[model samples]
Target: MNEGIIEGFNRAQITDETLVKMRESSARDVDNLPIIRENSAALYRFLITALKPLCALETGTCRGYSAILAAKTAASYTDSFKCYTVELDSVNAQEAIKNIAAEGLTEHIKVIHGDAAEVLASLSGQFDIIFLDSSKSHYSEMLPDVKRLLRRGGVLIADDIAYYGKTEAGEVPHKHRTIVNSLRAFIRQISEDEDFTAVIDTMDDGMLLAVKN
Candidate 1:
């Protein structure tokens, strides 16, 4: 995938060396971890810089890779905004806390450990951007909270919506049939909802980008 550039501003905040090191070191320790893909991460980073969100929320914080990118984007502007991320696994959350701190982003990025649904419900105040990377099946289940928590005109981005194109073709693996059905519902809901304007980018895995009315 070609490295993306955000014209004019010189995205020197996240250096190429940093991304390469992360993609290398992260995969070594994590078995089956769904770290954000190169182009996907670049696209999201571009969104953060473009949107200039004052506050951001992320459902899944896998070792803090995406969280770091978010925090860096937040830091690139001002310290007033913060990035809140949650991870269901205690191990991943703890590792994220350590890694974020190592990068001196502990203040900008806070890692919460628990089921995303419960954690999101407990959160107070709205956010300018929301990122979902948890179980695809849980998306529609969480849309109520997501809609309520997202500020007017806020952005919501969800990953892996295509399920390897199974969602469109209706040929789902037995083990992943439930997820495919749920994702299909999720995609349909966002696209048809009156309060939101959405589009699906056919990246490696699909990405649903929506803006609330």
Candidate 2:
């Protein structure tokens, strides 16, 4: 596709009305965290619409809100969408399962409970899209596994990349410094790696879109 065509395609997919509503709905119902800000709903919808991915994986399945949004968006193009979501907390996992079922999307979403790293290790299939929204401090450690799991041409979305000032120089806050260091290293690794081309956007806090080669 030409530049205009690609840009238009991205715009059309990003602006779906139903998808926008789903994102807005997520913010209202789920625990309002800065990381899971409202913009992610739209961003996720845009990604699904553009990629039309059949298989998607999310590292964090908090309340199942974002997973539901992703599944709903992916289903628009494919007859079915499989969203494998991992949550470390059982309570959150149970709630997500109920919410997903309540959304009438039990078939499209699969909820897994365990440490994300261990859970990811056991998975076999390559993903068309992967969203990293788990522990920020572990972002760097997760990159190798994430790379293995994502298929070439697949998209990897990272949230809160620019927030927490993790990449900023010097005088880091004690609480967020570790996460900051990890994100900085993680971003640098993706940027320098020959296997991926990435674009970091400041839409909400920060969002990074990396496409595997």
Candidate 3:
């Protein structure tokens, strides 16, 4: 976590010290992988605390940081909360399982190793909250299943929509153009869709939040 964001979270009293320390430790453990940004994590914490979701789903489980955070936060409000997180890489999935176990949240957070789209397609039951943090290019492709699996009043959060600012940049580099275009399309689809009330939070890289109506 960034020192500045940590300070802001402390001042706002959005998260407890324990979770903050866990985020810091997870960062050190997975220094090479991209974990959830501090600002984004705070946003997620706030939403989970407010929603008190009984069932949650996450598309990316780099080291189970976000899943653990959500599960712990939801545990405060409900005893029946369960979170299912998917990771495509087997190595990351194993690391996520280990991390969740270290947090003593193995019972609440389930780590599945498989392609996100395939897993989402196979999943049944509606989720109260759905977090999409997988490949930016596949977001649009996965929206259908995401919508189907989210309950009518569920919240859908898509992280890294800005893709290091390239999605909204006036001139995107050639290498990033494909993902930028894909993210923009995903944003447009969610923003224009009548079923959802959507907005983009320009914090961290950027997060697209939508509520299914």
- Which stretches in model 3 have alpha-carbon errors above 4 Å? 1-7, 10-18, 25-30
lDDT of 2 by residue, 79-138 (tens): 688999999989889978987887788999999998888888788889999998888777
List model 3 lDDT by residue over 1-213, tens digit each. Answer: 346855575436545565666566666565655778878878888899988899999998987878888887888888778999999998889988887888788889999899999999999999999999998888998999999999999999999998877898597888988899889888888988999998888868999999999
TM-scores for every predicted model: 0.89, 0.84, 0.90
Model 2 lDDT-worst window of ten: 26-35
Top candidate on lDDT is 3
Q: What is the C-alpha RMSD, rounded to one decimal, of candidate 3?
A: 2.5
lDDT per model vs. reference: 0.84, 0.80, 0.86
Model 2 reaches what TM-score against the true structure? 0.84
lDDT of 1 by residue, 122-208 (tens): 877999999999888999889989999999999999987887888887577799988988888888888889999998888658888
Instruction: Give candidate 1's TM-score.
Output: 0.89
Best by TM-score: 3
